[model samples]
Target: MQEVSATASLWKVALSLLVIIAFIPASLWLLKRFQLAQMKLGKTDIKILSVQSLGTKEKLMLVEVENEKVLLGVTSHTITHLKSFPKRGRPFDSELVQAQHEQVRQSQGDDK
Candidate 1:
């Protein structure tokens, strides 16, 4: 009887550990599926346009707030405004494409 009780208790402990291990992955999957990791605070005017990583702990972010676009330098402890651009009539994508074309033309001219 004593041996049987000990075996049952061991089985119960093993089952509990297995359940806890399974729960971690299950909860992670649910959070990723619903994108619950990022908190949403209703609707806001500020939008992140792009992010470029500078180092392990630093990044540059382009953000649009209200009518103006801002370039920000982000570090582990601080966020600094690097520059700001005036609101333009056209979309950012068009401006980016134009800049890319200009760069290509400059490179071609240099090679020639």
Candidate 2:
């Protein structure tokens, strides 16, 4: 196998550092732009504490927007995909939690 010289290795590292430095400012600018755009779109200051099902068909979301509690009807096909951010918080569901715990215990027993 061929060996790399110290000067060449140093040059490669310098180039990589330069590339990262150049992208840093551009990435920051883009992120700021995105946030500014989102702000301009007029978003709500809602803190969704809990959500529950209204009935067998309709779904409801308990949202606290600007110190005011509102019952928002979740107008979506799938109730499980009601997440805006990555892992915001788990919704309350006693039956689902119990079922999941039972499944986990069963799986562990089977593995052993």
Candidate 3:
């Protein structure tokens, strides 16, 4: 009787852990799907195009609002608009991004 109860308790623990592990990713996928649908419906005017973390709790975010682009400073407690500018030609330029990546790689190579 004692051996049977111990085996049953171990199985219960394993099942509980498996359920928790599965639940986390399932919930995340559902949330992402809902958010994407909302974006497709055009419910919001603002979008975050990119983010660079400045520190553990601070970041610089490039956001798009209507036809304008804005750079923002974000921290754990506050958000500040750093700059705003008119939209140039495209929302995102692939060539510009590629050039920036190349420059970063070259700089890292120089450091090493």
Candidate 4:
């Protein structure tokens, strides 16, 4: 009858609202907890100079990210401390690399 249909619709509406309300608190709690964890774990501040993938089983990362240059730590996954950097120069420190690059260029020039 009409009464039955109206009751069913009302119940449906109530349940939907209740479920939504329940999720809001849970989502808020999860968000707050994640933010707190990140803040606690974050080691950002600078002191890292560079990094090298020394082969995967463990990565070697240079710290200070600048002129300081200190090699520190090894990891299979990610230390979060070491982070990652491409071939940015400073850390792969060596005139040898530059010399090797020049040698290659000279060879190519000779070939041309």
Candidate 5:
């Protein structure tokens, strides 16, 4: 009787340990699956189109919410809206493009 009780107690401990070991991986898998589901279902609003780094802890983000595109400044502690771009079908920076082309032409002329 004494030997049987000890064997039963040992089996209980082994089963408990096995359950705990199995639960860790199972819970991690469930958490990852839940996050993925949230991402897939939460895609309707607010999509980030681009991000540019300004400094170590600051960034500029161009995001589209609904139909409007807005530029935002992001930092460690705050997010600020810098500007809202015009509606679709208009150029963003025609002069900037022209200036860049002129610079390239000047550089090529200098090289020649």
Candidate 6:
């Protein structure tokens, strides 16, 4: 009958929709699992060393490209090069720690 045909069509639509919904997540999972989200453009030399948030939309990033390390100021709308360092120097984290310790020592000396 026509009623049976209508019910069958509805079921077919529901099944198709469910399949499409499942396909989206499955494709995403496959992409992530295989690490295919980033397109390969030969060998990449740039590496992100560290990121520090300055505010809700601003950050400081230390990045290494080739043999030089760069300090960058990043915002939602812009990226600025703050400084660059030679690869022969101490690492970024160690220098940051050393600067912090120097600040603490200076503060303690002032408190005397």
- How high is the lDDT of residue 111 in model 2? 100
Worst 10 residues of 3 by lDDT: 86-95
Between candidates 4 and 5, the one scoring higher on TM-score is 5
Off by over 4 Å in 3: 1-21, 90-112
- lDDT by residue for model 5 (1-112), tens: 9999999999999999999999999999999999989988986778889999999999999999876899999999999999997667646598679889999999999999
Candidate 6, residue 85: the lDDT equals 88
Question: How would you encode candidate 4's per-residue C-alpha lDDT over 1-112 as one tens digit per residue?
Answer: 9999999999999999999999999999999999989876996655544567767576666776443445566776556543344435644447678889999999999999
Residues 1-112 of candidate 6 have per-residue lDDT tens digits of: 9999999999999999999999999999998866744635446898788999999999999999997889999999999999998775777799899999999999999999
Regions more than 4 Å wrong, model 2: 1-4, 43-112
Off by over 4 Å in 1: 1-7, 27-38, 92-112
Worst 10 residues of 5 by lDDT: 86-95
Q: Tens digit of lDDT per residue, candidate 2, span 60-107? A: 787675555565566556544343333324455875898899999999
Local error of candidate 4 at residue 99 (angstroms)? 66
Model 3 lDDT vs. the true structure? 0.93
Best-to-worst order by TM-score is 1, 3, 6, 5, 4, 2
TM-score of each: 0.56, 0.33, 0.54, 0.37, 0.46, 0.52
Backbone clashes counted, model 3: 0
Best by TM-score: 1
User: Could you tell me the TM-score of candidate 2?
Assistant: 0.33
lDDT of 2 at 54: 73
State each model's C-alpha RMSD to the native. Answer: 4.8, 14.1, 8.6, 8.2, 6.0, 5.6
**Residue pairs in candidate 1 whose N, alpha carbon or C atoms collide under 3 angstroms:** none
Model 1: which ten-residue window has the lowest total lDDT? 33-42
Question: What TM-score does structure 4 among the candidates reach?
Answer: 0.37
lDDT at 32 for candidate 4? Answer: 100
Please state the error at residue 36 of candidate 5 in Å: 2.6
Which wins on TM-score, candidate 1 or candidate 6?
1
